[model samples]
Target: MEVFLSICLGLGLSASSGFRVFLPMLIANIAAMSGWISPAESFAWLATWPAFFALLTATIAEIGGYYVPFIDNLLDTIATPAAIIAGTLLSTSFIQIDNPVLQWGLGLILGGGTAGMVQVGTGLLRLLSSKTTAGLGNPVVSTAENVASFGLSGLAIFLPIIAMVLVVLLILWLFRKIANLRKTK
Candidate 1:
């Protein structure tokens, strides 16, 4: 059950990564440093000050990038793989599986897949927003994504089960949004 909760937290964070890749990692870093959670042995560096600062910097940059006009679109192209990689790392860190191969395999599949799917959904949403509003609506979308990343990270740490439920709901919403976007195109 403990392991299950950790995976739940990881998956929740993974979903948040789709919105902002580094914010989830920064949250995990803080959680580790504060003794709220323990990362796997290999990921112990996450509890250190250097990792915290680095993730903080990256988080700030990522958030700021999304508020930029044309750059936000370019960032989406970069965010897909970055979100997958960050999601895999975040999930693998909390998971305590003994087997190296199995741990990473599950992280890559479940965590990466969750983040990648949501990243694509968000990218599509941004594209639709840009098309409909001529890029004026992107900042609003960016703000919402920022709020989601922060909210989900908080829930993932403090309420793993609730976080998982939100992740599910968010994914379902993303699917509906994607379908609607497709209809318009």
Candidate 2:
């Protein structure tokens, strides 16, 4: 049960990373520093002051970049891969499995996969919004993504089950939306 909860929390955080790579890491660092959460032994550095400040800087830059006009689209290309790496690290930090191989394997597969899928969906949404609204709606989308990343990261830390359920539902909804878009095209 503990392991299950850990996986849920990790995946939830990973999904949050998909929306914004650095936000989830910043939240986790703060949580760990405040004694609200404990990362794996190897990830103990995540709770340190240097890590906090670095993540803070990255988060601010990433969020601000998304508010820019053409820069947001350019950032998405780089963010996709960065989000996957962040997701894998976030998930791996929570996993308590005895075997390093199994832990990293699951982290790479589930964590990376979840983050990648969400990132793809968000990129698509941004593209559609850019096309339909002449890029005027992008700031709104960026704001929503930021909010979702923060909310999901908090929920993942405090309520793993609920966060996991929300992530699952979000993935399902994204898949359905993509399918519908395919049908139209």
Who wins the TM-score comparison? Answer: 2
Residue 3 lDDT in candidate 2: 92
Candidate 2: minimum summed lDDT over ten consecutive residues — where? 91-100
Candidate 2 stretches with Cα past 4 Å from truth are: none
TM-score of each: 0.94, 0.98
Clashing pairs in 2: none
lDDT per residue, candidate 2, 108-156, as tens digits? 9988989999999999989989999989999999999999999999999
lDDT of each: 0.91, 0.95
TM-score of predicted structure 1: 0.94
C-alpha-based local distance difference test score of model 1: 0.91
Candidate 1 weakest lDDT stretch, 10 residues: 173-182
